[model samples]
Target: MELEVTLLGTGVGIPHSGRAQAGLVVRAEEPLLFDCGAGALLRLAEAGLSPLEIDVVLLTHLHLDHVSDLLALAKARWLMGANEISVFGPDGTEAWFEALRSLYPYLEELDVSITIVRPGDEFSLSGLMIRAGEAVHSLPALGYRIESEAMAAVYSGDTEPAASMRKLARGADLLIHECSFPEPFVVTNHSTPLWLGGTFRGAGVKRIVLTHLYPQTVGREEEMVRDVRAGLADETKVEVGRDLQRIGV
Candidate 1:
């Protein structure tokens, strides 16, 4: 099976040019969408994909910047004559979807199934094995490790540097991590490159691509990569993710 990851949007909650909110697509037998943030639909279209093509949507958390596109994708897929899409998320997912449905009565017309997951849960989505793990964030968040026959990838969704993330990313072909700010930003729920490097130091992952960049990191891309490299071993490849960038898993 061919596994490829496309970064739809790399920005965080704050608005920034050239980067939308956090969203990514993992293309395999059936494309799986991860974190459909604000501009996900638009970016997906730009990536030469249709909203209806996504059969599975995996949400890491309920933050607006990470899940705002769920409703948008639902409506768009409905209009495009698609019937249902399975959505997987943390404990509050059902309640959050219900709240959104209450706000928009038309959402009731869309056929969507919600699955609530917990840490350490493992499931199969379109031939890919996915394992959920805890993410150190303010809300109940999850980081996922996805494995196929040919490759493996892990996504750190809106998390601070944590041991769980390191374990989940172990031996992954690629690690799509969040680099929300530069060094010494002093934040609890988010990660800075300087703080993350120590955590990823000596990690076995083959490559690491930093995403979810905030405006604070606009001009410090090189510096951020350098800091991450400083914490990692000499051979672990690190790169800053750009919108629409695609890499094989």
Candidate 2:
């Protein structure tokens, strides 16, 4: 069976027309939420899912745009009397989450288990296997490679150009990458089309859906797509991702 993937929130910290923050859902026997950003919880509801149904949350990093909704999810579940939730993320996740809990002592009643994962680590959830790789971001971050019975998908959390991600995503059926900017741009810790085109080399990616867009990409979506597509296989499917879009892998 194909794993259902939903792009709940596909924008950056900045506001955009219909875009929210960074988030996605990969559904297995149990739904798994990735990066509970500012608007992801609401977008999740819009996508015909409830925060209550999500028992696992996987974080790529601790950036605000990636984790602003962490407490909100906890509170929502607690309010609805849902079961406890588990969170998996890179190292320092435990300490960071503890700080959030300390600020909201009233949420202490809700039980949340956080597991710290590092680059090169692998873990299994439901019927899928997930492997973590390094990401080139300002703060420490990770990209994920997820595999099910027949298909594989990779998510580039928030990175510039990462060879580790390329290796992890080798032969992936789907790639949800963060295209933060367009071409002719000099940037660090975030990807431009030119940078990403070169970065995905040798990954043998089959399908790509770009996300984590910033306001600068407003009128240049096609150009961005064209740039990235030029570097991929002729049969590779590439498109700019939108909020609440669903795909199968």
Candidate 3:
């Protein structure tokens, strides 16, 4: 089996040149989507992938920066002659989708499937097993660990260096963790490289790709990388993710 992961959007809520929002596409046993933030559709098109190719859309949370393009994907797939699409997310996901669909009464008749997932929920589809874990964010958010026959990748969506995230990413081939702030941001519900560095110690993760970078992290990229490298004893590869960058697992 082969696995490819694409970083569609690596920015946070705000937009920037050469960066979009928080979205990722994982192509393995199943074509799974991580988040559908702003500009996700455009990034998908840039990657030469159509919305119809997506089999599942997995959301991390209900934050607008992470799920802004949900409706756009649904509409695109509907127009492209695809059948019902599956969307899995944390609690309140069903209500959120229902509210969005209400805005487009025309789509009410379309075939779309929305499944609400909670922490510790395990499910399988298209020869892949997905497990949802709790995230250290404001609302009821979740991080996912997807395992196929050959490899696995874990995605941490807008978390603050929680133990659950480390547990979920244990021994994974790739860990797509968030590095929203630099150091000394004094913020909650988001992570800084300093904090993440401490949590990543002895985690045994193969590689770390930092995403969801905020504007504050613009000039501090090198410092973040150095700090993360200093903390990990294992020779873990660290890279700052960019929009449309493709990674193989």
Candidate 4:
């Protein structure tokens, strides 16, 4: 089966002209949405896709920047007469969705199934194998490793250096990690070049795409990539991700 990822949105909570909030569309077996943060629908449309084409959404966490558009997707699909959506996310996900429905009573009319997942959970959807990894974020969060055939890719949400992330990315074809800052500005929960570089050390990831970029990284993209490259072994491709970039897996 073919596997590819379209970075629908790559910006952080703070807005940037060329970037949007965190989101991705992974085409594997079927179209799966990784996250649906604010402005995700706009980017998806710009990438020539429709919410009706997506039926499964795998959320890494419940952070607003990662899930703001969660209801928007369901509403769009409902309006388009698409299939009912199934959502999988870390613990408290069901509760979060329940609360969202309370505020938007109209969404309660849509059919959305929410499945709560935890770290270390392994499951299958269609032909793809997926595993969840714990992330070292401020709150409980998860990272995902998705494998299809012999190809594998890991998407690590906003996090700091975590051993679980390293284990998940080991020998993977692609690692999409968050690089929230360039350097010198120490951060917790979020990742910087130094923190992100440390997480990649010895992980054996073939290619690294940096996303969830904050405005601070606007001018220092090259330096950020350079710093992370220092921690990875030679031959590992590293690049700062941009919105709407499509990556093959």
> Relative to the unseen true structure, what is the C-alpha lDDT of residue 114 in candidate 3, on a scale of 0 to 100?
84
Off by over 4 Å in 4: none
Backbone collisions counted per model: 0, 0, 0, 0
RMSD of 4: 1.2
Q: How many backbone clashes are present in model 4?
A: 0
What is the Å distance of residue 226 in model 1 from its true position?
A: 0.3
C-alpha lDDT score of every prediction, in listed order: 0.91, 0.89, 0.87, 0.88
TM-score for each of the candidates: 0.98, 0.97, 0.96, 0.96
Error of 4 at 196 (Å): 1.6
Higher-lDDT candidate among 2 and 3?
2
Top candidate when judged by lDDT against the true structure = 1
Model 3 lDDT, residue 201, Cα = 83
* Tens digit per residue, CA lDDT, model 2, 1-249: 589899999999998889999899998898889998999989989999987898999999999899999889888998999749899998889899988889887888888899988899998998899999999998889999889879999999999878888898889999999999888778999988767877786678898899999999999999999988776535677899999899988
Residue 59 shift from truth in candidate 2, angstroms: 0.3
| TM-score of decoy 4 | 0.96
Which has the better lDDT: candidate 2, or candidate 4? Answer: 2
The sequence of per-residue lDDT tens digits that candidate 1 reaches over residues 6-61 is 99999988999999999999998889999999998899999999987997899999
